[model samples]
Target: MGLFSIKILLVLIIGYFLGSLNTSIIVGSIYGTDIRKHGSGNAGMTNTLRTLGKTAAILVIFGDILKGVLSYIIGNIIITAIPDSSTLYISGIGGMVGGIAAIAGHNWPVYFGFKGGKGILTSFSVVMMMDWKLGLILLAVFVVIVAITRFVSLGSILACAAFPIGAAIKGNGTVFILFSAILSILAIARHNGNIKRLLNGTESKIGEKKRA
Candidate 1:
């Protein structure tokens, strides 16, 4: 295979494996329980916080964010070795590909029965690495929405939806924008259950513990 192809393959493989390392599951295992069996039954940061506690939740969320950031850095480094006139562009695309792979892995982790987090934190980190301006904008929107509505899922959905739009407004390449859109779609899809509860006014707000 060609050198570029080999590099791309390596990026995808590494990103997937890294993403598959679900922090919530790992933290839950340390406490002798499966995070997926508790609270919202979703093995993401919000669920971790609700099922576990602040320490475990913080660790899991940070770990997930690290997965995305590291994936982008590693992919950028791998693609940088290619001798091309468009090295910057190639690296940017490679970084996005790696980030997307990580998000996919987080959503459907092979290590956890194809079940994992909703990928919001990981996507945030990835977008930050991809474009800090866009990332900050989305972050602001998320914070405002969550603070106003106390609905973490709603905030996450809105932020994900804004990614592609922000990318487009910032004149990101078509491929990058398209990939962002795909990531947004995946995030929204993962939150399907939350969407249902939200519509029915049965969704859990941030900081509200699940009832026994």
Candidate 2:
């Protein structure tokens, strides 16, 4: 039991370290831009896209989301090794879970003075572990909403809301429900600028990208 517990803690520390690698900052630095100094002052995919180009944006998004997924897998594998939920190696499903840590890493990367993106991609990656089916549904919602409204913030916010919507519909336990609520709040916090622009009706559309 003690060994199993030690392993889980090891997973947590390793997962956090893995999550701390901030790709946005590296990409931005490569381009001679702080990225945070650019669009929305955020080190995120949107800012990368707006500042660099499509390729850079895609890479950043993929990398950020991948880190989340990979770290979750790391923790998940450790938990699985214990072969029972009663084991001390099991991790919770709350905000401090594998998914949330990834988001934390993105929003406040230890490698970069705790300055990072809002963790939207990392949040989405969380669903990948919870249930790819739900993730796909939320993803579809994200695409449709983003396509119709052309407002990235609106799409993300709505999709996040879908978490609770799906949970309530499926009669899920409180873990996912509580996670949805907190994820929504984090998403909102990350999009404070977009929120302002949205209030003013000046937020950019997908293709009509603007400089921050």
Candidate 3:
């Protein structure tokens, strides 16, 4: 009802729609295939790389990252535009809300039958936009884990779990930390299959070719 509430709602709606673009699926269709039906059945960069190729994967990464970044920007813009704002940190809250909605959309894209990627890249991009330093730290954490185990899923899981903790340690406000935690939970939940495979030592390692 209030202008602030309306702006926040608009940001969420726009962010989710942007995220629902589902870059991998779009690229797969351009190549006459459905990426979700191949490899790990994940419409993500890694699976796109395996099923399509480097170019398609790059496109997916770019598109996914773009949507995340745009969502944050749109959220910030919408909130900051409001006059006589009661909340001093409302812009940050808006950004977080938009970012999380985008991740949700990526994880379960409405445009693609509510099935989509794990939202790893989209979340990473959103966090990076929110706090570059923390984003770099998380990126380092992910790289180290993936480099050590060659398991992208494990890296993603651990990095996601660390986000809220890192935000807390950095003295972020409660809402920011809570939003980060939500992103973490969403990412981990989306990787449920990967977690099971990891426990069983059956999860595909990064760069592992799918058998034809």
lDDT of 1 by residue, 27-80 (tens): 999989799998988888888888788999999979999999999888888888
TM-score, cand. 2: 0.85
Q: Quick one: best lDDT, which candidate? A: 3
TM per candidate comes to: 0.94, 0.85, 0.96
Ranking of candidates on TM-score, top first: 3, 1, 2
* Candidate 3 C-alpha lDDT tens digits along 18-55: 99999999999999999988998999999999989899
Error of 2 at 140 (Å): 1.5
Q: Arrange candidates, best lDDT first.
A: 3, 1, 2
Off by over 4 Å in 1: 84-89
lDDT of 3: 0.90
- The predicted structure with the larger lDDT, 1 or 3, is 3
